[model samples]
Every structure is written in C-alpha cells, then in structure tokens.
Target chain A: MITRTLFAGFGGQGVLLMGYVLSHGAMHKGLNVTYFPAYGAEMRGGTANCTVTLSEEKIASPVASNPDILVAMNFPSLLKFEPTVVKQGLVVLNSSLIEESPSRTDIDLLQVPTVELAREVGSERAGNMGHGGSSQGQGKVLRTQP
Target chain B: MPSEKMLMRGSNVVGEAAVRAGCRYYFGYPITPQNELPEYLSARMLDVGGTFIQGESEVASINMVLGASAAGGRVMTSSSSPGISLKQEGISYMAGMELPAVIINMMRGGPGLGNISASAADYYQATRGGGHGDYRTPVLAPAGCQELAELTFVAFDMADKYRSPVMLLGDGLMGQVMEPVIFPDFIDLKDLPKKDWILNGCEGREPRAIFSMLLGQGELYHHNLDLQKKYDQITAEEQRWETKNTDDADIIVVAYGTAARIAESAMNDLRAEGLAIGLFRPITLWPFPSTAFRELAQNGRKVAVFELCLGQMVEDVVLSVGERAEIYFYGVPGGVIPTPAEVADFLRSVAKGDGEVGRRIDV
Candidate 1:
C-alpha cells in the first residue's frame, strides 16, 4: 500500500531533511518515492513542509492532500495540517512547543514531546531525530535508536 | 544486478542529462527555482570538457545560445518566467535563423515578475512562439523527475533533428523535487550528423550566410512560409501523450506539466471511489496530442481541463474538441496548485454535473 507522509514545521526545523532522509531510505528499498518541498516564501522562515510518498507501484502525485501520516514540528503546523489528516491516520505532534492536543478523535494522535526528549538526552536540537525515530517506529521501519 | 539509482534533485538531474546528451556549451543567467540547474552544470560541464558561462543577463545568455548554435555547437540555456521573457528576443532570432538549440524553462508564477513558485502559467509562452515570429517551438512537458531527465536528453536530439529550438517545460516543483534517476551513458558527438552550415573559418568551401534579414520584398514572406511548413512537418511527426484508464472512463482529466501529475493522483483517488475518471496528459505541450482530444470527444467523455494558469491550455482543448464534447475548465493563477484531495473532490463534484467543479466554467 502507498503511504503518504507530510512533514510540516517552520524553516530550519529539518522538516525537509526529515522528508529527504525518509525518501532516500525508501528509494534504497527499491520502492517508488517522491520528495518535494512546498516551494513558496519558504526561505523566509514561515511554515515549511515537504511531502513524501512511498509505494510499491509508481507514485502518481508527489503532493499529498490527505496524508496518512502528518508530522507537525510546530504549533502552527499542527493547527494547519491537523484537519487534513485522513480518518484513523496518525498525527505526530511536537507537544513540547504545541501546548494543546488535536481535538480530532477519529485518528490516532501521538503528542511526542520531541524537544523535551532530545533535551533529556542533552541536545535539544536533536528534536528532529527524536521525531524521526518515532515516525520510523510508527511506519514499521525497523531501526535502532541513535 | 539492476543499475543503482541516484537520489537527485530535478534541476541537477536535468543538467546531468544534458551533459550526457552531448551538450558541449551551456549559457544561462541565474533564476530562482532553476538556479540549481545552471549552478550544477557550471562545474560539471568542465569535467566533461564542455564550456559553461553564467551570462550577465537572460538576454545575454540567450544571445550566447544563438551564437553557439550558429557555430554548430550543441548548446543550451535555462531561465524562469520573467527571465524567459527577456530571452524571447534571442529565441525568436534563433527560430528566424533556423538554428538548433535546447532551451529549458522551469516556469514560475507569471505575467510580470510574479513569484518563484511552481506554475504552468507560461504554457502559451512555451508552446506558442513567445518571440515575435510565425513559428511554433516544440515543447516537452515532464510530469516527474525521470521524465524530467529523459525529456531533456531527447530535447537535444529533437532540436538538432528539426533544426529548431526545443523547450523542456518544467515548474518550480519539478526543479526542486528529488527522485531516483539513473543517468544514461554519455552520447558520442561523432555519431551525430555533421553540421555543414556552421561558420568554421572558411577554408576551400563556399561562404555560407545564416542571416534572418531579408531585404527584398516577399523574401521574408516566403521564409515565413517555409518556417510554417517546417513547423507543420514537426507537428505531423511529433506528438506525445499518456492516457490512464481513459478507454472506459466517463470523464477525462486533461492536464500537462506539474498539473497533470496532481491530476493523476486525484484520478487514482476517484478511481478508489469507483468513479470512472481518467487522465489525459500531454507530454508535448505544443503539437499537443490533439488526436487524443478528438478521440476523447468521439468517445463522448466529458473533458475537464486543469491548469496552473488562468486557463491557457483550455483554449487548445476547445480548438481540438470543437463542440464534439463539452469542455470544462478549472485553473488557479499565480502558482496556486490544488492538492490531490481537493482535485478529487472537484472532479467528483463536476462528474455528477450537479454543481460546478471548483469554479468550473463551460466552454
């Protein structure tokens, strides 16, 4: 089955990097994939996102509308993308910055305090890594923790 | 074992493909959404024993292309929307002189200096002659990264074979997107036909003139007719398109470039709902697979033309269908692309004909 993933956050949050790594890994597995940045005013530190689609068959569109997985690294990203998630899809929110939880009940929500977890490990900037690990675990990609 | 694929950005892939296609000369001005292309080729061209020049302006870059092509070199230039406008003068000159050159336009938002976003708004400019001439530029619109590279590779040959400028039309998303690509082997320039029209230091051969200026009356007129005949021959020979589930579909989504990819995804979503929706993607924007439209019209399938521009390609669709089928248009100007789900929703609503499809207008 094709899985559509959207990683949304402010610029410099490694949102694009996360998507890129995922796409790379997917490609190495011989799976069809596409990774594209949301290209507009993204250099100015507004909401930045990248969409990645991995499928056994050829991917039709690189831009995901109702992504099966939504990774929001900021509060605005969560608020913006939460409504677009498919029912019963997973929403991985960076709860360290976003104080409120998503109100949707149909989908499985994981309020991952990536920043707090990374800080506990002594480097707060490794929040993206923490989130990436959580995503891999949820997506059924076997990997050891860094 | 299968060839290992490299995860490459679309712009850099285009550059690599051009180099592999035996492009020995590169000239272009830096433009956003496609700067990576020229930047990649700048260093890489030298490795292949090719020349690269970052011209001062788009106008200068295109003129450089004209000069290189006149010298019978396989050359290329790239730009975005606004920059493409500046290159039009040189492009027209290239057409008038019947020189072969490859031009890449990673189109962005348009009209003026619109914005650096993925847009197909320059459809008219790319397919039709943006320059002042009665000529048609061959345009190839690639929807994905693989096609992005492969089309650029073929564009060089098309340009050389026809002795006219060929355009590879892409958008910002096409430039920025990353996908797996296996670079083809380098082309041997020796295998290609010799260009006898080149101005290589006149020695023992009669002097040849490659000028667009025609002073006598009816001279330019006949030249225009000859160019038109050449364009007609190209149109008759080259037309590329792809159809997905079109044979048994009730509605057909007609789109090109990046917009067509989005529409294909939406078509899949609709297919999941048991809706009989299909997609007709024109790989060549010019010589735009009008036969496909005629067949769709004959099949009596409703046509929905989606574009990133304010309905530019819709005009061509109408001309092709010509009351053979009802034509509906949905477009978003200024580089706003609808998501797949949004497109599916629009198509779903429109297929029923109960309501409009996202501001749909009947033509």
Candidate 2:
C-alpha cells in the first residue's frame, strides 16, 4: 500500500519539516519512502509545501500530482490544494487558523486545532507539530510519533 | 547498524557520498533545488578536514575546481540550471585541459531562468559537452537516492580514471527528495592512486604544465584525436543501463533519471493490466548505453521516448534506434510534471493505436 501526504503552510510553519519527520520515520521502519519538496523560488512568507510518499514497495515517482491525504496548515494552502486530494481521501486542516469549512463531501475531514493545541502546550510555534500528530492518526503512516 | 543507516535528503546523500569517496575539495555557488548540496558540504567538508568554498559565482566555482583538480585533488562543484550555464566556460576549459573533476547538475526547467522544477532538458548540454570545443562529458543519471549515492562514487572514480570532467545529471526532484540510502563505506584517501600528470610541487622532477591551448600547427588536431581515443575507450567500456521486461515487449519506453522513475510507475501499472510495455533506462547518459538499446530494437519493435523536457534525450533515442524501429516522443516541458496515471493513459492510447492511419510513432 502507498500513502502520499502533502503538507502545506506558510514558510515558517514547519510544513517541510512535517513531511520530513514522517518520511524519516517511515524509512527507519524499512518501508519505501520519498519526501519531495518544492524547494525554491517561493516568495518570502509564501506557502511552503512538501509531499511525503510511503509504501511497502519501491516508490517510482517522487512528484506527487494527486495525494491520498492533504494536510493544509493555512487557508491559502487549503484553497490551493483541496482539489488535488483523491476521492475519499482525508483532508486535515488547522482549524484554529482556517475559519472556513472544507466544501468536499466525498472525503473524510479531520480539523486539527493546531494553534490552539500548541497554545495549550505553551507555544503556538509548535502548531505544525500538533498538526503532524493529528494527521498521523488518519493514515497511521508511522507506528510511533514522528 | 541502525546508527549507520540515516534517512538522508537526496542532496545530502550526494554530499555524504562525495565526502566518503575522498572528494576533499568542494567549490560551488548555491542554486535553488540544489542548494542543500552546497549547504551539506559546507559543514561536512570541514568534518572530513577538506576545504569548502562558496565561490563568488558559478564561473569562479568551476575555475576553483579546475585549479584543485589539476593539483590532483578530488574536487566537485554543483549548481542548478542557470548557474550551470554560467560555469560552462570553466567546464570546457577543464575538459580541454584533460582534468579530472566531478560536476553535479541538478537540472531545473530552463532555456533561460526556467522554473525551479525537475527537468531533463540539459541532456544535450551534459552529453554533447555543455561547453565549447570538441569534447564529451561523462554523464551519469541516477534514478533514485540509492543510485544517487552509488553513482556519485562511480562519477568520482570515472573522472579520476579517465582524467576528464564527469557530470552527474540529476533533476530538481532528485536533489530535493529525501529517501533511504545505504551508503558504502568511506574510501581511504591514502589508498587512492597517484596521478603522474598532476601540477603539484616539483622538487627534483621537471614541472608539468597543463593547458588546453595547443597553438602549434596540427597540435590541436592531434590533441583532439587523443581525446577522441579516450572517449572511444570510455564509450566501449562504460555503457550502462537497466532493462525491464523488454524481451517480449512491443513498445519499449526509453527514459532516464527523473522521467525513468515516472515511467517505471506507468510501466508497472500497465504490466499489471497485462500490457506488453517495457522500460529501458540509461544509468549512463553520455556513453548513451546504445549497445543493449540497439540489440533490444532488433527487427522493428516500437520505441517511445519520454523526457521531462521538450524532447532532448529523445534525439539520442532516435540515434540509437535508427531505422530498425519506429519511435514516439512524450514530454512535459517547463515544470509541468506528469503523473503516472497520465503516462499510463498515454501508453494505453499508444498501445491501442497500433496501426491506425495516424499512428503513435512520431519518427
């Protein structure tokens, strides 16, 4: 089975790190994995994203066109990538930052109050980590916390 | 064992491989998608007691490499598309001087400052020699992180063995992707072979001079011929490729580097559907790997060339397949990455249009 999750948010939100942590954990488990990022040319404070693919078989392409899961940590990311999620795929949103609800009815939705959760933990900067923890529940992509 | 296995970023994997392979001198200017390479080496080189310099520009970086390599140092430089273009002159000079240096090009979409996305558009530039004069750069195209690490060692060795510049042609995806790579153990620097032609210090022996300019009459011609002889030797011995299920196949898909990875995904999907599609991937792009390709194209099999650009490597495919087989071309140029489903759909359309009035074969 192959699970591809795309994580997207503003540049400082640790979006790329979220994907890296998951892909790194998957690699330690001896599962085939690839973490591809949109590495450059992003305007300062612009959306930064990465795709993490984990599978039991050797991954073929690192480019993710359609992902099995979309973790949108900001409103712009949700607006941009919500359409690319496969039918019946999961969409995890940082509900604290995104006031709008997802329009798609065909797929499951997990609204993670990441900023609120991070605030409870004493630092809102850890919102991405909270989001990552929540998204992990959808696919169980890694056995332990990443 | 567990501690030895680190999940590394693709760009860092190459850096780690180079450090292990005894590449002690690294000079490069940072470029996007490939920035991680220089970033990793900047610190890692110091750990290995090597020199890492962020040159003023790509031109400066390549020239720095030329100086180091001529002095018998295992040197490397890396850049993305436009930055690589800036280094072309130095690359040509190094090739002409018959110097050994490793160049890593994480190709991005380009004719100019193309978008920072993976591309194979530099095939001609890398294979036919991106710089001036009559020469060819030994090009290795690795498909994944594992191959990226392994081929990095091969690239350094190939450069030293042939005393010529070698290019590792990876794309932005190849550079930016993070994956599991089991790297080989480090090479002992003391165990490496000594280069008799090095321009190092001369205590008693006559000082050797290295220059590409043979201004004397017929001097340049003879030098070209000698370089051609060396190229011929490399061509004869270094053709490398990976063929999958091509024996009974009808249309063989020819791809390398990043395109080959997507093609594999498409090939797998089609094979599961009981199709006769096969994959032919060239691990070494400059040597072209034509011997097996020509043999596989025996007696009129169809060949489909897939590339990340507007058909750069497809021309090489045309040269290899010749008149023996009909060839088709599919490409997504300028940062438009095609998915496996899209590629499989294209293949299905090709397989279904076997002998229609307007067939799938473009050549």
Candidate 3:
C-alpha cells in the first residue's frame, strides 16, 4: 500500500521539515519514498506544503492530488487542503489554531491541541510532532507522537 | 564497510560539490526549498579560499556569475523558479559570449507568478533557450543528492569543454532533502585547461578580443553554425540516461530528475504485480535520451511519459517514438506529485487497454 501525506503551514512553521522526517522514516523502513516541495512565490506566505509518499513499490508522480493523509498546521492550511484528502482517508488538525471542525464525515478527523503540545515541549515548532502517533478514539487517524 | 556516509540535505551537497569542483565564486539570492544551498556555500567557500556573494537579487547574482566567469574564474549561481526567470538575460549573454559557467535552477511551479511548488514546468525554458538566443545551454537534471554532486562536477567540465553555459536542473525536493553524498577531493585548478578566451589582462600573448558581436553577416553566420556544430556534437556524445527493468518489458516509463526517481518506485511496484513495466530516466535533460527512447519504442513497445508539468517532456517522448508505438502521458500539475500506487494503477490500466489519454489530476 502507498501512503501519501501532505504537511502544510506557514513558511517558518516546519511543515516541510515534517514531511522530510516522515520521508526519512519511510526510507529507513526500506519503503520506497519521495518527498516533493513547493517552489516559487507561494513560499513567501499564504501557504507552504510538501508531499511525502511511502510505498511498497516505486512511486510514479511525486505530486499528490488527493493525499491519503493531510496534516494542516494552521487554519488557512486546513481550509485549503481539507477538500483534497481522499474519501475515508485521514485529517489531522492543530486544534489550537483551527477552531472549526472539518465538514466531511466520510473521512477520519483527529483534532489535537498541537500548539499546547508544542508549548509543553518548550517550542511551538514541535506542533508537528502531534502528528506522530495513532489517532485518539478514531482508529483511522494515526497520530504519531515524538 | 565505510560507515561515514553523512546524512546531509540536497542543498548542502550541491554547495559542497561546487566547492570541490573548484567553483571559487558563487552569487545567489535566497528562495524557498533551496536556501540551504547558498547558506552552506557561504561558509564553505570562505574555508576554501573562494568567495560567495548573497547578491541583493537573482538578477544581480546571475550577472555577477557572468562577470566572474568572464574573468576566467570558476563561478556559479543558483535559484528557484521565479528567481530563474530573472536570470534569463544573463544566461543569454553567457551563451552569446561562449562563457563556461554553471547555473542551478531548483525548479518550482509557474506560468506567471507561480508558487514554491515542485513542477517540471521549466522544461521548455531550460531546454529550448529561455533567454533570447540562437544558442543552447546544456542542462543536467539530477534526481538526487548523489547526482547533485556528480553532475555538479561534470557540469563544470562540460562548460569548460564546450565553452558554453551549463545548468544543473533540479527541483525543490532535490535541493532541500538530506541524503548521503560522497564528496570528491579537491582538484588542482592549475591542471585544468587555461581560459585563453577570458578577458583578464592579456599581459603577454596577442590581446584576445571577446565579444558576441560580429561585423559582417558572414561572420555571424559562421559563428552561429559553429555553435550549432558544437551543440550537435553534445547531442550525439554527451547524452546520459538510466534504464531499469526494460529487458523484455512491455511498457517503458520516461521521466527525468525527481520525477524519474519517483518513476523508479512505480516501476518496482508494477513489476511485483506481475506487470512488465520499466523506467528510463534522463540524467541530461538537454541532448535528451531520445536515441534510447526511440530504440525502445521501435520494437512496438508501449511508452509512457511522466512529468510534473502539463506534458512538456512528453513532446520529446512522442518525437522519439515517431508513431512507432503508443506513447501515453501522465501529467501531475500544480504542485501535485503522483504516488507509486497511482502510477501502478495507471500502468495496470494501460496494460489492460483501459488507459485514458492525457489524464491529469490536480492533487
């Protein structure tokens, strides 16, 4: 099975780094992996994201249109990418910033207080770590903790 | 076994490789997905008795590179999509003067004012002369960090050998990701060919005049023809590509750089599913591996071209096939990267005669 994940947020929010870490972990596990980053002006602000694909076989297009997993670090990111997640896939949101819940019910949703978790970790940058483990209550949404 | 393989990001690898390649001058403005390149070079160049200039803008940086190259020093410049657009004029000038220089374009999305997303949209601009010109710049598209170093070294050699500008065409992922890279030992600059055409003080031998202008039509035509001849030579001899699972395969996937690496993953997946799919990745974008593709297509084998853009490289794939076999296109646009399973599904559909032509998804 191929698992495609998209991590998106602001420029300095470590969204891209989260994708990199997942790609590294996938590679370490001997799975085929590809990490593609966004380039150009969108990097300045608005939104930034990277696609990470891990699979049992060689990957074809590194661009993910409907990601199996979507991890949005901010409100705008969640709003922008919430529509792109595959049906019955998984969505992990930072509850501190994203006050509204996803409208979709077909997919699994995990709302974590990532900002609070980061504060506990002594850095807001650690919010991405909130996506590190299996989802709470919802078995579909896996949130891997640091 | 040697256990010292450092897990370094792609940008640092490119920077280190440039320094090892004897690139004494670097000028660049920062951009996303590739800032690590300039940052790493900033310190490394100082240690190697070289100079790195974080120019105020991409335009200024490329012009600085052109100036340094004209002075007979090994110089380089790097930027992403939008920044690359600004350096086209300088690239054209570099080509016109037959200056040997290396430029890196870590590609991103684009049409006009695009974002920082990985896209093969720059294929036309990079391969077909972005700057106003009747000249061509040899472009090397590296898929990973290893190629980041290997191609960087080769780019400098090719630039000096052809007396033309060379580009290391990569994407954001290849520029920012961390991976193991074996750095080559430094080479003695004196051992390399002396730049007789450079405009540095011509103290002894008859003063050499370096100019892109020609006084007469005959002279201009001759110069253009000369450049064409050199390009033709490169096309014939300097082409490079990698083929996987092509032996007795019914389908071949053609891609380059990061796309090619992704294709590799897809090919393996499809192969395990009892499907005969192979991968053909071009390391050199310009002087593209048309010959190999043509040879593969001649046997009535099905070929599929995969790219991050809206079917730019597919044109070349079709041209290479020459209607000998079916050539399909899988285009992933707007910063969307297709997964291996997605590719496998597409290949399966094609093998089963259920494939659709020009199918695109906006993920």
Could you say which candidate leads in TM-score? 1
Q: Which residue pairs show backbone clashes in model 1?
A: none
Model 2 chain A is weakest, by summed lDDT over 10 consecutive residues, at A137-146
Candidate 2 structure quality by residue, lDDT tens digits, B1-363: 212667787889999999989999999998888989999999998899999999999999999999999999999999988998998999999989999999999999888988888888888889988889999999999998999999999999999999999999998889988888888989999977788999778988998899988999999999999999999999999999999889889879899988888988888879999998889999999999998899998666678788888777877887887778877777888977788877777677678765431234455
lDDT for each of the candidates?
0.87, 0.88, 0.79
Q: What is the lDDT of residue B99 in candidate 1?
A: 95
Question: What is residue B83's positional error in candidate 3, in angstroms?
Answer: 3.4
Task: List the DockQ of the predictions in order.
Answer: 0.76, 0.69, 0.24
Q: What is the TM-score of chain A alone in each candidate?
A: 0.91, 0.93, 0.85
Write candidate 1's Cα lDDT for A8-117 as tens digits: 99898888888888888888888888999886554768888988888888888888888889999998998989999999899998888888888899998888888889
Model 2's DockQ score? 0.69
Q: lDDT of candidate 2 vs native?
A: 0.88
Residues B14-95 of candidate 3 have per-residue lDDT tens digits of 8888887889899999987688899998899889889999999998999898889889989999988889899999999888
Docking tier of model 2: it is medium
TM-scores for all candidates: the values are: 0.95, 0.95, 0.79
> Tens-digit lDDT track for model 2 on A29-82?
888998888865765687799988999988888876689999999999999999
The ten-residue window of minimal lDDT in model 1 chain B covers B354-363
Report iRMS values in order.
1.3, 1.4, 4.5
User: How much does candidate 3 score in TM-score?
Assistant: 0.79
- Count of clashes, each model: 0, 0, 30
